[model samples]
Target chain A: MSDEDFQEPEVLLPLDAWHRAHGARMVPFAGYSMPIQYEGIIAEHLWTRESAGLFDVSHMGQLLVSGEGADAALEALLPGDIKGLREGRMRYSLLLSDEGGILDDLMVTRRADDFYLVVNGATKIDDIAHIHEHLPEELTLNHMDEQALLALQGPKAVDALARLVPGVEALSFMTAGAFAIAGVPAWISRSGYTGEDGFEISIPAEAAEQVATLLADQPEVKPIGLGARDSLRLEAGLPLYGHDLDPETTPISADLGFAISKRRREEGGFPGAQRILAERAAGSAFKRVGLIIEGRQPVREGAVVQPDGKITSGGFSPSLQKPIAMAYVPAVSAVPGSTIAIEQRGKIFTGTVTPMPFLPHRYHRQGSSK
Target chain B: MSLYFTKDHEWISVEGTSATVGITDYAQSQLGDVVFVEVPAAGTAVEKGKEAAVVESVKAASDVYAPVSGEVIEGNAALEADPALVNTAPEGEGWFFKLTLSNPSELDGLMDADAYKTFVDGL
Candidate 1:
């Protein structure tokens, strides 16, 4: 690559050089030069599972939906009942187009009288523009341009985080709260992409380095790159914006109908509500599912999904200790235990569709007995 | 026994009719994480400069070429489940296979350790 190869996007991380100095294999991701792996991806992936992994995710868009009428303004673009979301509570919702296809899935949280939104790194620009164009003028969309996002994830994440930012344990899953991390005012959310117990910390851009350094000093934390992040998310059965989803994929077909509230499905007010509601009631043509490959040979993106279905993302999964993949297969092939074939280097290999999170998800579900 | 390397970053240690093969440290570094290794089964014949095995990282896959023509008498099945062995000790436990050299003269075509070091430095 050349600088010409990438049309630079906004939101670069504060620790770009630090990542390179540590022998990080850098790649262009979400408009930033970020480490894809350090000390190799497999090691980082396994380390994250067995312990904790720290990820620099500042390139993602963080914005505050505030001012009068913000809640109603946002409700027009998404199907989720944002008005019902209480302060500090978070909900996973989709940004939909007129046809009910998904533009992106984002987290919407309620503040005292405002909404805080976090959107995917790759689609944040479009997400912002979509909000600006759709929402009423009384509402204001303020993008927090100078902020850094860090994710500390895995079984040991809470212990490591609690040591630095006290009272975080009380926040619970799908919750966000304002707190001071090492004297720096920040927002901490008990949410992440790794399907492990984790926290996503958003700190001021100037304070990012100090916070990252503080976390790096912990014995349980190591800087994980995009390479391990990909495998971890793949193993977790989470979707990557451009790969697992796009404007063409509706939430129903993507198996994300759960994000739409029951009231929203019945009332039918959001974009593409007709198509989405019909799909929800009638089922979709194809669905996204996980695959456990027969051998050690890991398939990759665009490796023709044989017999017609195609894989959007595929790689060696560190969590499962085997190769796994996510693909859009025909509805018949999307069921768990359905046999399929993926072609690599002109040869077809056998695989079976398996429920996602190749490893059981360890999210801190609320109201569970300890 | 002296170790020699090919330009493709494969290293071979030859003592006589037998040789051990693995990837060079530089190759492993470029590969990032070693997740899976697919080696030719034991008793398989491999031609020089041909794809005899594969090593995969989270990001991509690479073909490991045979530096010398030979019959693979032993493949490292341990790598199938524990590919990290290659990252941990590429020269020792990470060795991919043991080959019975079909043509001893092929050894002369490989670069010695010193030459290989120079080759890697330039890369």
Candidate 2:
């Protein structure tokens, strides 16, 4: 066969037609033809910050693990305290290699009968194989390929979602519940990547279009694409899987130590526990720090930081209207006010280390005043 | 003044030996919202078909190639304050730079307005 014939075809999402009908610009991403933008990235970004935006993130991998001792089995691989996670609660965790490198980051939710995990789309296949190899034969892992995910995020997200699924207003951050939207069964969690009040709804793939349309019909809701999603998350200081977090990086170096629960820290039973705990006590050689660029031109990923560091994720922040980036720098120079120099495309750029979430997070936590 | 365009979507308006260059409307629209622009300063020499300016959108950056060899006379300083002009008026106030042509005959190899429109249509 010719080289062209050997090329793999791009996969289509369940809401492909819906995105096109809304004027989305489709681009190949993560082996799938996904919508990169509609109207324009800047316009959609600002709209989401001001009101509510509906995003189709069905490309994520959803899995259900159940059977006897499932929580204990999972705790062996992940550093988070899984066994202590109560029903209807969620916690972020990392899948670490035996050498203590981060394989993937995921959200684990304990349901009444099983544990539901949401992993990155690009690493789903490898993650599944690794889990199967490590988990005992008694546990059953089911891949929910037929399910579609949607996220409604922003200041007015609760208002728009509550109108469609009543009683969703009661769900606090990191909480999940079984709900029905337009008579379709759904599993919804009060969580999202954007630093805003939001919810992630998972429903059957066949009902994706129906659910998406009903939400878009809301006065405050607009159909957003991946372009806006990237800018939103960057402003929130959230790290991406492939760019910011990778197998070469550890949770301690990536500034994700919060995911390691206190119980797991003392027990030292999880993978890479030895290396991770030591890093926590002595500090890692390199630390991830957020930088605010000094000029208009953005220093994107792959930019070199002077001495011994590299930018992992960098982009223009729509909210701050400035260039913000995340880079790994020597632990001694990682102070919030330290200055750093970066080189990109043969040009030198100056950046100041700043605390992340360039814009303060607005998550609707329980008992938090708006 | 006669207008000529390159296959790269750059348009140059020539008057005697002086010329002004900018990207076409189609180019700006394809780039989406413009956030930053970088142009050659005065007294800088440029080669034909080489990168002369840069235009960045919210998603990515693109290079604007020179249509003909010349020496830059002035860059659009207005863009420093408001780069959105590239999207709002790509052919007018959004002109990237003004240059003195080294070889005026080079313009003859470029496409006319109607030809550029047809080329863009075929794309």
Candidate 3:
């Protein structure tokens, strides 16, 4: 009903100086100064899909949750099978409210004595506070703000990263392990947001610039900005937390049923379990679906569509050489073949509802594609 | 023949009453790789400061406003197939449309290349 009143001061990332030296176009995003582009968004996007892209995502909230019942405690806050998560394995899960709304979507990894979490950057402050309120006091939640996160992604990401960290090629998709990169102790995960075969490396902040320089020196790797990172994730059919998944959006409404593990779905112990389970059975009012826009103009996010749909995420697909978008439409118009029109600035563009990952995912799983 | 610019970053080259319209190199660089371009059809009347064309990049779509009131002479058909031309040659073949100026006096409010360069630098 009113204008947003909260505006926080932006901070600089660990590699801010490094990015400036490399001719990155810096912009404000998620309360931090981030690189929107280096060479160019389209060029960087294509390079990442073709070869390798090095992304600085240190703004994300990395945390360590430790205690005897930390796993079950986290499971209570999310509708994910946290207890079933094996050590060195990662699970994409949602931080849900008790009233069935989404707070954030995060990646959780089971460690030897604690659970590791990587939460969305913008909501990390609130996410940590929310977790604290839900978890038991005995469990320690340590924010790893002093660390930096880098994602090396592409088809050649494995070969490029193996140049510094040997034997990491053995880790399969959705797996994590401790590895030494550039003589610095780091936690390397074979899971990435790009839906490409890549690794996410976490290093100490002091050593961030050196590691990034070493990785960027590789012929296969180039510094990609937030623009390319966003395009890459959109192509991967990944829902950004602030854009696609919001407070009013449930996992079922966002078409994130895969995040709700089978055990959790049946046991129904997590927050908002009753309402979510009901929606899972009798369809939510709106369903998230993919669209291949018929024109070159990207149906940008926040555009409303015909026959009752609201776009959550939309952009140009570099891989498909077309425009693509994700929107939530009424159940009746959620069919794959349905045609929708989006009117922007007095011009109308037609779009067709299609299956997502507008480009095929290149994730290397154990033995076969999932 | 004379060239003029607008605060919105559109550029117009005047040859008598008919003028060629396109965005400046500064604008093309700002918008990045343009994937789609939609110019008003021939015979369509556009008013100064009103939307005349649309340009879309991978990140977002932007409206291209008319620098002066005119009737569209023709839209660039080549742009319908290849919009990246706007990026490579924004001032030449990348022109969005040719307009028959209804009021040549409207051009006086626009900026010259030197003034536009100063304005862009200030921005």
* DockQ leader: 3
Model 2 misses residue A220 by how many Å? Answer: 0.4
Question: TM-score of the B chain in model 1?
Answer: 0.97
Order of candidates by lDDT, top first?
Answer: 2, 3, 1
| Per-residue lDDT of model 3, residues B37-82, tens digit only | 9899999999999888888888877889989998999999999999
Better of 1 and 3 by TM-score: 3
Error of 3 at A243 (Å): 1.4
Of 1 and 3, the candidate ahead on DockQ is 3
Candidate 3 local lDDT, A1-370, one digit each (tens): 0112333346888999999999997878889989889988889999999999999999999999999999999989988898889999999999999878999999999999999999999999999999998889899999999999999999999999988999999889999999998789999999888889999999999999999999999999999999889999998989998889899999989999898999999899988999999999999999888899985778888888875778888888888898899999887778889988876555587888898877889888988742
lDDT tens digits, residues A99-201, model 1? 8888998999998867989999889889999999997877788899898899999888888888998888777789989999999998999899988888999
Worst 10 residues of 3 chain A by lDDT: A1-10
Ranking by TM-score: 2, 3, 1
Chain A TM-score values, per prediction = 0.95, 0.97, 0.96
Candidate 2 chain B — worst ten consecutive residues by lDDT sum?
A: B54-63
Instruction: Report the error of model 1 at residue A271, Å.
Output: 2.0
